[model samples]
Target: MKRTEKKRKDIIDAAIDEFREQGFLGARTTSIAQKANVSSRTLYNHFESKEALFEAISEIMLEQNRSMQPVAYDPSRDFVEQLKDALWGYISIITEETAIGLNRMVLSELIRDLDRSRKFFTETETHDYPMTQLIGEAMDAGVIRKADPVFATNQLLALAKNFFFWPEFFLGENPTPEGVMDDCIAMFMAHYKTGS
Candidate 1:
């Protein structure tokens, strides 16, 4: 990489760690500069303010999430298996360290800046996301019971969050075990499967 690009990445990496540890308000630009082994002037050259640096970190986290886009639902495949694959793919990403840190970081920001948090939610959140698209497709094909695709999508995602994301985010727990995913999938299928 070019020198400037490497320095930019270094600043972002250091800023992420510092923000994760100290939060947006508590994190110091000087500390981030020290951790990145760059002067405060260099950090400022890359980021006009701490908020700008935080925004860059948020973009990195969002990009990481976008990278794990689930495979499109296949009509020929078993619907239950497809749901499992999709949920697992998403769960893996949310349980990642960076994702969790970003979640916490966003929550911290939300306390101080509701507008920014709402904007972030609208832009970055996966609530009305790819999984929702898959759910809608499955409904159109009659793979699942007749239902509101939006509600059903949220329900299934809630199950995954209940089993995985919430616990890890709130309790510092490990990733949800495969057995938990299996149980959640089975429960979801029981209710949503076309003939169930």
Candidate 2:
């Protein structure tokens, strides 16, 4: 079982690398098999088809990302501190070259296949379980006011997303700089900050 798990992980990692480099349609199972140092037959035993392997890679990446998120916001922290934590989390994760490449691959896939684009959106959206839960709690406690949690989620997420996601997608050099987080939190809090 341990050996099977290791082989599975090896194949998934190889497939992820291949798909990201070549896009899904362009990626080759033979290349992935060679990269994983596994025979074609062994690879097929692990994954039924190229689509199966790619979906496996996508699900694994999504689940891995979801698993790393925090469970909830610290109720004890001030709203501004919480906002900073959320914003900083987005900045820290998405700024990396690996994350950028993954996003680029998703966008390219979206152009050819709407379903693939939706896959990326679904993975990114509901997958941040911790943050979504916190947004609910904050609304319940009167720390922020919104009729619907989803609306609040959109607003808060939009604050952090537009800043870097735009720059990332366009390869724009300017990023939200180090000092800007504080100002961001300040602006965000001015709009929604409240007491329990």
The estimated TM-scores of all candidates read 0.85, 0.80
> What's the lDDT for all of these models?
0.81, 0.71
After aligning candidate 2 to the native by TM-score, how far in Å is the CA of 104 from where it should be?
2.9
Query: At residue 22, what lDDT does model 1 achieve?
Result: 88
Q: After superposition, how far is residue 69 of candidate 2 from its true place, in Å?
A: 3.7
Model 1: per-residue lDDT, tens digit, 119-191? 7777764535457767778888887777887788778788879878988888888666768888877777788
Per-residue lDDT of model 2, residues 88-160, tens digit only: 7766676666666666665676688888778767767775544566677777778776546666666666766
Backbone clash count for every predicted candidate, in the order shown: 0, 0
